[model samples]
Target chain A: MPTDVRLPENDLLALALDFLLSHGLNAPQGHSLARMLVDAQRDGSFSHGLQRLPGTLNTMKHPRFNRHADPAPESVSPAVVRVDAQFGFSCLAAERGIDALIGKAGTIGIGLLAVNNGFHSTALWPLVERIAAAGLVGLSMNPTHAWVAPAGGTKGLLGTNPLAFAWPRKGKPPYVFDFATSAASRADIAMHRNAGREIPDGWGLNGQGECTTDPAEVLAGAMLPFGGHKGSAIATMIELMAGPLIGDRMSRQSQDFDHGADAAPCHGELLLAFSPDIIGGAGVGEGAERLFAGFSDQGARLPGDRRYRMREVSARDGIAVSSALLQKIRSQTA
Target chain B: MPTDVRLPENDLLALALDFLLSHGLNAPQGHSLARMLVDAQRDGSFSHGLQRLPGTLNTMKHPRFNRHADPAPESVSPAVVRVDAQFGFSCLAAERGIDALIGKAGTIGIGLLAVNNGFHSTALWPLVERIAAAGLVGLSMNPTHAWVAPAGGTKGLLGTNPLAFAWPRKGKPPYVFDFATSAASRADIAMHRNAGREIPDGWGLNGQGECTTDPAEVLAGAMLPFGGHKGSAIATMIELMAGPLIGDRMSRQSQDFDHGADAAPCHGELLLAFSPDIIGGAGVGEGAERLFAGFSDQGARLPGDRRYRMREVSARDGIAVSSALLQKIRSQTA
Candidate 1:
């Protein structure tokens, strides 16, 4: 019955890794995916957590999927590196490029890594957290298949198009957040749908290209860009930076590449690292402290603070997994 | 009695220059300020246009103002330049550093110019437009005096914290937009107040830390950050990037430096330029065309299209200045 099992952090990670390994993934590949899932679960991002495993496993051995693809870093320039992900998921690709990108930023004050032919249906916080931990500022942008409409138009011309930035502070958790340019992320909409709740106005448009508050219609149609035109512009910016700029397919092109396949949706990401020490002089630490002060003056929660707090709590008490998800995950592991 | 007066663009530029020169500014300094004002007016950005001159004139002759000071570009590294704006207007400083910044970006694939001790109560479009004209991507951010509160906090601790990004396309106006990280820009509130209208909810909070639709109360209280916590986080990001990271003052610190004086607000801006040909590969042109295709398919308006269209008409047909503004300008010129 599974009965809504609560598993220790290590056990969850082991289970995910074992499940992935049985599906033709190498140990390192399995480890990368497992770490991403466990980290998301521990951080209270349940949508990106274990619930995603079953869908991912179904695609892991897709006939057209490159199960053994290995991403290798190619230094396209002194400050830019391009990774050919060989049509694999980006978790392992990011793992392979993180050190190389950081090393380049250390020397040149900045570094850019482009991940082409990769898919990332995962939160970007992990890589950004690592970058910040290494005392560098990190910025990332990526595109999934298109689901968001442009500001004035009803047709979906862009992806939700997430962008992330992170800054590190000594003896404290890094300031980090990854946000979709859409008014609401897919997960938020999914939660509303599951609850049989109406979404807020401006959350999305119906398939008929009209505004609607029904979660189901929005899921079946298009998401609205957040902050109106400003949000749309950013999504376009992300499209350029992560798509053709990186010599990869844009969202629409990726859609064509996969022919609307949910399994192995081909997408791409752009990751950038900047060494605050070189670019910001010695004022980086002082600057971050002052910002912290402002946040405290108003009890403003820093971005990613909630996630860090949740991580600690989950690590201490374990993560609660839904019975349905646990049951499905167990079958895959078996 | 003066009526709404339309004046030729050159005439307006000359008039502004004359007014600044009369305030003891050198020819170059006067021209710098005048150019910014005329450009803003030409683009139909009335708030940043002629309406701002009187306050600027008062600041020009303040006892604490550094009249003869000029910012010079100091290349700190191959990819970064620092400009100490010398407690003067940033129009001239931006003018002085644009060439150096562009050249560096052309060489190194990217350039960062940090403007410290400068005032820029004008639209940032002209500079970004120039960068785009040179076939590069441009990004700018700055913090002025505090006017926006962090999300969930009653106290205002940040500026509107505007961010601008521009991307150039061949044979077309650049895709450019600038946005304040507040729920509503200061100008929007001012317009509502002028029109004797109440603002929408969530625009601002009264002094008592309660939401209010009254523009007067909002002006007396705090402006809400746009998009809730996400907006607050971005404002914080801008605060760090434009303030301590640039070796200058944060929004609150700038407010303190001004001591509530309007004269030379002592704010700063962060400018970055990236060459698409270098970082975005050789397919950038084709890529941009594809983006335009997407926009055309959906009939989405490009961000800077209207402004560019306005500029062209203003250049040919002159700008319509309000009667009050015209009267004030005529008085200064006389």
Candidate 2:
């Protein structure tokens, strides 16, 4: 059995920043990456937390990875902000563009920010949550490496292609959800492989296009989108809007760029922000509360409730990680 | 077996327009509804075609139904257009707002149109296709009557909540897809009921929350969202964005307004337009073609191919419907 090791939030953040800085990421990039990893840990989103440190390190070793690249954002129009990530991580790029995105939404009632040429590995909820914090509604989506098949096709042609949404609330956390279009996330499949466990049915097909439960086979094969064709359509939508719509690499191109190196996929992201004050008017908060109450009145949980709950607990008692993983992360800093 | 009756596209449009005008709809409203129904028939989307005329007639009989309301579109901000449907059908409202929405996107790269207090029963494809025709990407979504359950909950609280997306293409029809978040559309369920057939599993649950193939039971109970929890989340997002964000009715509220009379649900519709010229620069159409080719190369049909193919055949051969239904519609005009 793996022992659990608990660490204060600040300690984990410091370790993450140190690891990134030692690995050649600049100050702003390190802070952005470190903050994202720590927040994910704090929210119990372990799939994107400290456990991803080694993957980040591996991606850094790629020759094309520009460790010192600083993203530059340009206002292309009244409601459009375009950011060139310059081959760096997406965290800082998103960070730099957010205020402008929010400001445009504030003034024009809606705004769009498209981040191009960024390696995006973190969960999207954080970015949308920030928009919600500003009392605006946010929608974001991006395509990653192609590892999923289009519906009715046998080959990998779509990415997991996660879609995320956020709505601001009054005196509480915002309503938010971020999820992959795939039946199962790559992280989930990788976890199953690491544990030598069989994946559930409907997750993926073998390379031969036959359904299989073997994680390794699925890794080499193609995952199916959730909800069949509808999910596939959405994944394709994400691919278009985040890829060619922003003049960034499509999922297949992102994977080809890796050349089987297993590094983080480099691509673009699209975020749209809307101001409730301007769009929904004065009753916005009250109206949203009614919907939220409907969920809690029943036993049904809102999408981010569990994560928010975990975040509170972590804030109080710190984040607990498997001792072995904790040691691995600690050694990365050295 | 029901005898098939084939009618020219112009004949069907004329019949529909006459039926609506006779039912007390104003000229513009009649034209809007007639065009929508005919277009749906032309595209082989029978669910929203002339088959819905009887339902429209039934809805018109409701006391609160407004037959002469003219929608008024207001520019709320540089990127937001709000149209008050004045308790009339949404089609004309959408028609009135599209030019403004397109203009805003052309100037600002992104635009949003929110139609409030409208009865939206038409398929969303026609609307998004119009935006695509203007050389822009379009997205539209709206909540219908409450008939869907949250993923883990048994009761209906969410709408079927159709979401539509369209991207312009060169020398071909735009890539478009519109689908309900529910496991199966209410139209499909109603078709099953009318045919005295059992629906497929996963479509819905009985009042007790147990899955059932009986379409009647599901109708009396709740429909399931497509893709389990992820679909449920998307449904919820649609509810928030289309409902509270637009200051319109939620699905439950829409159903409540019908007072169990089953009239078309009066609510709001949200449409967003994005300009590729400003956002993606010069390579969008060509880049999208590459993605489209990838789909064709793998023998994967694009999302809107079926509808577009049907549209061409309908253009050449006209539309086919059952003789019995055609007689019913003809008698309604009388």
Candidate 3:
């Protein structure tokens, strides 16, 4: 049995690119997906990193997967950029429209980008971070497959809908936070199940709607939204904004579209961008710095601080990957 | 001593208007404030209704308040509406800019209203509902005084930030949710303390940063965020967006500006409006109705369902008010 092995970031990117390209993805599509995965691994987000590739490969082989579809961006209005992902992965679609989104925001002080008919499985922070890097405030959210229950309902009617926010700062990374509205992410429960570990309380309910600690039971039934009704309301808001409000599939509808094939959810996403320089005047960056100081002074961890630390470590040393997973990737291309 | 009294909605509005005008607010200012309070009462959001008037009166009396100041709205860019509240209440300022906001969103698919140099203590739902009533989606958030602590740290550094969202619906009231990021609203804790009841766990921490059920201790110390870290992150985002990002005061700075006078916190509020027809296509409302049906079918309560139910009852039976509170209102103008 091969153990965990370390690989350079470039090497990891190369491996991911090879796997995606061999699976029939165009160069642009393959690069976008590979870049996001490599970045996730560099930041120690293991669940969103290489571990997701196996599932991606499977989804790619599905009949619904559009191997060569080209995402097209349309300027729907002065401040709105709508991108149709052409039923392909959302990565290249987002990449295609981000510049237009940023340009509109820069000129008008506010902008919105709506991505419809897309598949989103990666973390949202990457996109928000891109907006922040351009010295703008970013807010993004999207719906996934319906796996979580509405608060008070036993049946699954909501996705593990995720919301992400980023604020630009001076001389450092943007203040970024991306989180699932569910008590825990689906990936978290999957990890627990794979490890044969019981989940903690409040994570999910069994098929009968009773609380369950068994990962398998929760997986078969429904995951709970965090903080009871409050979290549920947020999740509902996300579903509306990222789904119906964007003219795309809601979580339940997305799952139904899969027809039990278990592919990545195809839906839509909404991103709002605001220019601090235009909206707040100058010195906005300084004010944001003060807020960051408040967090550090209170000994409170900033949302993405740990990830940044891991990023530095990954830069100094290579990312660690399971040896078997690497061999599996190679075998796919063979 | 009189018992609980019942008053028609018009009478309540007149009472609020009388009190505000007597306290030196201009006609438009007084009307805006009165309309919001009475509407809150009509919806059974008692905490944000007449209960908030005394604080507004006090803030109006404070040296920082511009009693006769006129709120001004200026178009900062193609899609941005900036309103200066002129150190007065935010209600009149929001009223001054709302039409422009709706117009911009209608024209550009998205619009942003940034209200700066304003004092806000009322519920945020009324504003978002107004946007939704105009057939647009609305999102609004603002930071209050520093009354809550971050997730892990003990000291009070974050505000009890409030976020509100609304979606337009056809042939019915809009779907809406407005909530504080705190585990419990400050008013809720105050009610418990006044009733001599212990608070539930996770609501707050005592002065030493230890969890406590004593509402008094919590009031003296710090309120906890709902959903722990996730809620804290949202709160922090609110603080930045409504504060520094818009050239307004952060919670701590707002508190400092009060100089122990305990007036309403002077800060800014941000509202983003989106036109569903321009972005989401014509069938968006139908899709949203389907999602609402999903909730009702599963016996899940939509966020604003109870409040809407109460609204109908208030319209039918009039509003019931504590006689003592009514007497106090009369005494204010005596």
True C-alpha contacts between chains kept, each model in order: 0.44, 0.74, 0.82
Every candidate's CA RMSD: 2.3, 1.4, 1.6
- lDDT tens digits, residue span B161-240, model 2: 99999999987899999999999988789889999999998899999988999999999999999999999999999999
List each candidate's DockQ score: 0.55, 0.82, 0.83
Provide the clash count, candidate 3: 0
Q: Which predicted model would earn the best DockQ?
A: 3
Model 1 CAPRI rating: medium
Residue-level lDDT tens digits of model 3 in B1-334: 2226668989999999999888888898888998998888888788888877777876886788988869888999879999999988998898899999999999989889999988885889999999999999999999898889899888788899999999999989999999999999998998899999999999999999899999999999999999989999999999999988788888998888888777888889999899999889879999999889988887998889988998898889897676787778888853
User: After best superposition, candidate 2 residue B104: deviation in angstroms?
Assistant: 0.4
Summing lDDT over every window of 10 consecutive residues in candidate 2 chain B, give the lowest-scoring window: B1-10
| lDDT of the candidates, in the order given | 0.80, 0.89, 0.89
Please give the lDDT score for candidate 2: 0.89
lDDT rank, highest first? 2, 3, 1
Model 3 CA lDDT for position A326: 87
Error at A278, model 2, angstroms: 0.5
Q: How far out, in Å, is residue B89 in model 1?
A: 1.2
Q: What is the TM-score of chain B alone in each candidate?
A: 0.95, 0.97, 0.97
Q: Assign candidate 2 its CAPRI class.
A: high
B165-232: candidate 1 lDDT, tens digit per residue: 88888887788888888888887998899889999999999998789999989988999888777677
Q: Estimate each model's TM-score.
A: 0.95, 0.98, 0.98
Model 2: residues >4 Å from true position, as ranges?
A: A1-3, B1-3, B194-196
B279 Cα displacement, candidate 2 (Å): 0.5
